[model samples]
Target: MVGLTYKILPNLTAYGGYSEANRAPTPLELNCSSPTRPCILASTLISDPPLQQVASHTIETGVRGNLAIPAGGTIDWKAGLYRTSSTNDIIQLASLVLGTGYFTNVPETLRQGVEAHASLSIGAFSAYINYAYVDATYQFSGTLSSPFNPYADANGNIFVHPGDHIPGIPRQQLKVGGDYAFTPEFKAGFDVLIVGSQYYVGDDSNQNPQLPMYWVANLHASYQITNNVQIFGLINNLFNNHYATYGTFFDQTTDAQFAGNPVNFVSDPRTITPAQPIAFYGGVKVTF
Candidate 1:
């Protein structure tokens, strides 16, 4: 790893760096590389070919600056861009068996992104904001087995080409937060988080509709009653927003058959893990 920094101005600076990393495959990844014979994790163990270690090279550049206001406030900001390329990338794919998957190594993959952050402080009030954009894609062409995928071919495999977006990674995200002091002993804060949509875990070929974007808000406050006692409260997901943080493909029909339910049923391959709903919490803190 190497890095460089230059002072472009009295209050500004530019910086860049390059780094290389290697990761060996885990025992689970090494033992479950066979597609024809999908293993059920610890229950089904088998011998498989060894996998190559994953290697990556990353490059990043950015600039940062601080500004002072004559009125009695300060501003700090930074922006940066980064790119990483990896070889022998290990990825998990669904197999012909229901509720099972296998791990395999892809020839190449890439992840590039931009990020920026800014903050302002004035007396008892402070605020900050952050934003990021990510473009994660496959750099090689190949086929993966995904029997549950609706678009899978006759052999229960899907063709993946270069430039296909990787599943389960959002392309954009934003967060804004601020804090205010009403008195020397009381304080309050609020924050908002927004996340962009992305492909499902099994939609590596990018053939299915993406998970919808969503946002959430939260509020918190605290009061000091005495030198040894304090009270705090928080309200999370203030708006009760309905969202899912993760999604994947599954066969509902097969599950019904196993349960001995009626066979006449509609098959919905989509499955999701829903995010938390609005909730409130409060507590008192005491110091000896």
Candidate 2:
């Protein structure tokens, strides 16, 4: 690993770095490489096949600075760009069997992105915002089994090509929050997170409907009661926003209509785990 930094200005600095790393395949990944003999990961191990180690190379550069407001507050901000490429990257592909998958190495994969953050402070109040944009994709061509995906070929295999967006990774994300101090002993803060949409799991071919975007907000407060004790309150999902963080294809045994027909046993393939609703909690913290 190598890195360098330069003072471009009185209150500004520039930095860049490059690094290389390698990771050996885990026991499960090393042993589960057979599509003909799928194992219920951790519960069973049927086949053992050697896999190449994953090697990653990364590069990053950025600029950071601080600015002061003559009349009131000060702002600190930084922005940067980064890219990481991995060779022989291991990936899990869903198989024809329900709730099972096998791990194999892909030729190459890439994850590149830009990130920026800024914060302001004025006397007893401070606020901050952060945002990131990512472009994650496969860099090789291959075929894998995805029986649950509607777009899979007749033999339940999907072909992944170069530049295909990887499943379950959002392209854009943002967060904004603020904190205010009513007094030395009392303070409160709130934050909202926004996430962009991406392809669902098992949609490695980029042929299925992508997940929808969603946002969530939360609030928190704290009061110092003594030198060693304090009280706090939290409210999650402030607006009771409905959302799902993860989604995948599932095989349903029964159809929606339930018409007592033996042949109609395929319901919606999309399955999701819902996010939490509006909830509140209070607690005490001791510094002892």
Candidate 3:
């Protein structure tokens, strides 16, 4: 990795960086190669058909500055752009069994994004906002065959086309928050986070319905009782909005069962886990 930074003005700075990274496959990926002989949990499995490591190259650039406000406060802002490409990217393929999957490698993948944030403070009151937009997609064309492919035909094969959006990754997100100091001993703040939707796993062809976007709110407060003692409280998921951070659809039933008496059994093909509900936490901090 390499980086460079230059001060363009008294309060402004510009920076850029480049990095290369690699990741080796795990033992599970190396061993799980055939769908016919699925390894159940708690069973012994040996690594077979060694896998290749994934290699990535990335570049990023950004600028940030602080501006003095007429009211004796200051505003800080920054913006950045980044791009990364990876070869032989390892990915998980859903299996016929629920909560189980195998790993495979894509020929290539790309992710590029923009990010910006700004914060303002005028006296005890302050506010900040941040936003990011990502374009993540596969850069290779091929066919993926798996027992869990939701779009598979009778033979269980799904075609992966270039530019398919990777599943479970939000393409856009935003966060805005502000805090006010009631006094030297007390403060309160709140924040809202928004996440955009993307394609679902097992639907790499981009033919399935995408997950819906959602947002959540959070609140926090703090008070100091003495120079060395303080108390804080937090309430997350203020509205209790239901959402899922990750999700995928697959047929959880085995092939033999489906072939024997397909009409005698009913299966819920889509599985989803819900996000945490509204919760509260409080704590005290003490310093010597």
Q: What is the C-alpha RMSD of each candidate to the true structure, in Å?
A: 2.4, 2.4, 3.3
Clashes of each: 0, 0, 0
User: Candidate 1's residue-wise lDDT over 154-247, tens digit each?
Assistant: 9988889999999999999999999999998999999999999999998889999999999999999999999999999999999999999999
For TM-score, the strongest prediction is: 2
Deviating ranges (above 4 Å) for candidate 3: 26-45, 97-99, 252-268, 286-288
- On the 0 to 100 scale, the lDDT of residue 109 in model 1 is 93
Candidate 2 lDDT at 114 equals 99
- Which model, 1 or 2, shows the larger TM-score? 2
Highest lDDT against the true fold, candidate: 1
Ranking by TM-score: 2, 1, 3
Q: For candidate 3, what is the TM-score?
A: 0.85
Candidate 2 vs candidate 3: the TM-score winner is 2
Which runs of model 1 end up more than 4 angstroms from their true locations? 36-47, 224-230, 261-264, 284-288
